[model samples]
Target: MNLADVPKEKLSPMMQQYAATKEKYSDCILFFRLGDFYEMFFEDAILVSRELELTLTGKECGLDERAPMCGVPYHSVDLYLKKLVDRGYKIAICEQMTDPALSKGLVERDVIRIVTPGTLIESSMLDDNANNYICSLYYGTDGSCALCFADLSTGEMSLAVPQGTTDLTVRIMDMLSRYTPAELVLNAQALSLKSVMDFVKVRLQCAVTLRDDACFSLDTGRELICQQFGVDSLELLGIEEDGAGACAVCGMLDYIRETQKRNIARFISIDVVDSAETMGLDLNARRNLELTETIRGKERKGSMLWLLDDARTAMGKRLLKTWMEQPLVQPLKIMARLDAVEAFYKKSVSLMEVRALLDNVYDLERLMTRGLFQKASRKPHRVT
Candidate 1:
């Protein structure tokens, strides 16, 4: 719904303002900043009240029927947000834009940030050892598609183009399962593909957001990516000469702009992984091999990782998972890994000492992510 679609004639001053704001963020569950509370009204209130198991209450609107209303304390908004996001919902945080004490009539309010499952950086909202990847896929007219991944918690971004093959959907679906992003943004072209669309919604069970096809243009993509990465050209970022990968990156960036109104996911640098460089595994293969989890019960008990993993820290655990999923195809890289293991084995005393020291180590990478979110959303809780 747009502003015009809102029932302007029926709503009073505050309700009218809310109606307009709701129109703007129709797709999101908006938490409108009211005094001491982040309130939801109308349909959003009804949905959230049921989802969060909050009291389904009512508020006065200028109409015959009372408006549905629900809220949580502003100070504890993150608690509610976590619940909603965990259930695959996006939250738009509307904040009072002006000082209530100084304002003449009603306080001016605007969206501060829009939070989603994929872009959440708060420590309370993320898993310690798991990567929270937000991905975007762009489908080109030539039956080729590019995918990009961004992890807000680690500031790791990557891009890969699916190898040109007849069974493209299988490859794409496998890649999706491998990364396991919380949210995905697809261009119009990608969303149009029935097979791709079904895989995203059914197989991956990820929240899908759409972008315009024009945004996926190669020139715009290169310009947007180069600007964001602070590079002169795509070559510096190791993006392919073709723009499909860049387009996917730009589409993801655009979705960040839309969903994360205030805090966009930070990207320090990108690591481009070529498809041929790593061993690729499909869903069936992963299930049969029991690489991460057992086949029947789908638990970690009898998995290969369960047998091999003895990592001390969350970072080590996450890295180990990645290494297991995509073992090196290159012989030299494999040998280098073996050499490191051999060195560790040869010096048993040093290995034991190192392990002991690592036992006390904290997950600094996740700490950095939480710190970044705190800095971005840091503000005094004033009625403004």
Candidate 2:
């Protein structure tokens, strides 16, 4: 096959399979595995090379004149993957499904794993004390979908049903602050829900999916919630909801069950907090100051593990998770923690001393494993 003979409009079957995988994982940088190296094609090549600092090469695809390609060795995928993820890119890991020697036709390829900022479970890429979150969206029968999220690492769970388009953005922003989920899932037909999710994806550098089967009916949500909690109704949990809320709640539980990490989220708190009531911080500011970057160089010196070392009680650990998850919200809670630190500082403790105290806090997975962990303790010391 020569480059001049390749058709421009339609792709070949192999290329079509690649395109399908790419479309299914548009939000992710699809690491399409061809052989020893994880190959990326076309725009994915451009994006991955630029992000992962790899050499941009080209590969012959039938008659195509060496289509753009870039790749990383399978052994070193984690480092490049972490770099891309740290820079906020979800990666869909496409692997060879069958042994090439055993297969008669083109080597089988399938996406065995999808890595998102929040849904990361790999120990090397995560902190031990942190939580990873996956968000689920369920619209009611009346074109209303509730957003429910859970982070199993720290056992944080929350649900919110946006009333209309006007509330959807704010509701999502609020959830962003509270959960900071790595991935978001929504109903396929929920266009409004999808739009809101897209906005969040752009803002948070996260992954979003539209799954029709995931959205449960209102009665179904209620039934799941009741069954999970072993209660007759939601009223037992002090949850007062119309039919819509019931469905949303149930859809959330169903997703959690399907994910097969039953004990990951221990149901610490559930509330109907309005986004308007919370302080507004854009996604960029939140991610920079809280997650990837430090408020000051001094605080970055220690491990998150060290910070939690002094947390003697379960309540303290839970408080630590809450702070990590919603770093920008609950000002009163953050202030209290700051006040505690200030008291320690007042005892002739040098800033370097505090930095040294935090030096042992190094569990990235544990720190970010749950949705409720916050890094406010390391914020620059406020005088007043």
Q: How much lDDT does each candidate structure score?
A: 0.81, 0.61
Clashing pairs in 1: none
TM-score of candidate 2 on Cα atoms, chains taken together: 0.57
Write candidate 1's Cα lDDT for 1-384 as tens digits: 223444688888998889888888888898999889999987788899999899978888787678889899988887999999988998888999998989999989988788988888776677665688899998888877888998877778888778846488877887887897899988887866788778778867888877787666666667777778888988898887576887888887777766666435467678887877788887678879999889899888799988998888878888998888887899998999999999999999999999888887777776666665663344311110
Runs in model 1 lying further than 4 Å from the true structure: 1-6, 164-166, 262-265, 375-384
Error of 1 at 377 (Å): 12
TM-score of each: 0.90, 0.57
Highest-scoring model, TM-score = 1
- Backbone collision tally, model 1: 0
Off by over 4 Å in 2: 1-13, 137-147, 152-176, 182-242, 246-319, 323-384
Quote the positional error of residue 85 for candidate 2 in Å: 2.8
Residue-wise C-alpha lDDT for candidate 2, range 1-384, written one tens digit per residue: 322234644566677677777777776788888778888888889888787677999876654366788888997787888788777677888889999789898788988666656555444565434456677766655555567776554445666655534565565665665666776666665556554656676755666655655356554566667666667868776566565556556655665554432432445356654544345555555545544334556243353534544553333444565555455466776688799788877876575676565554443323444323232234322111
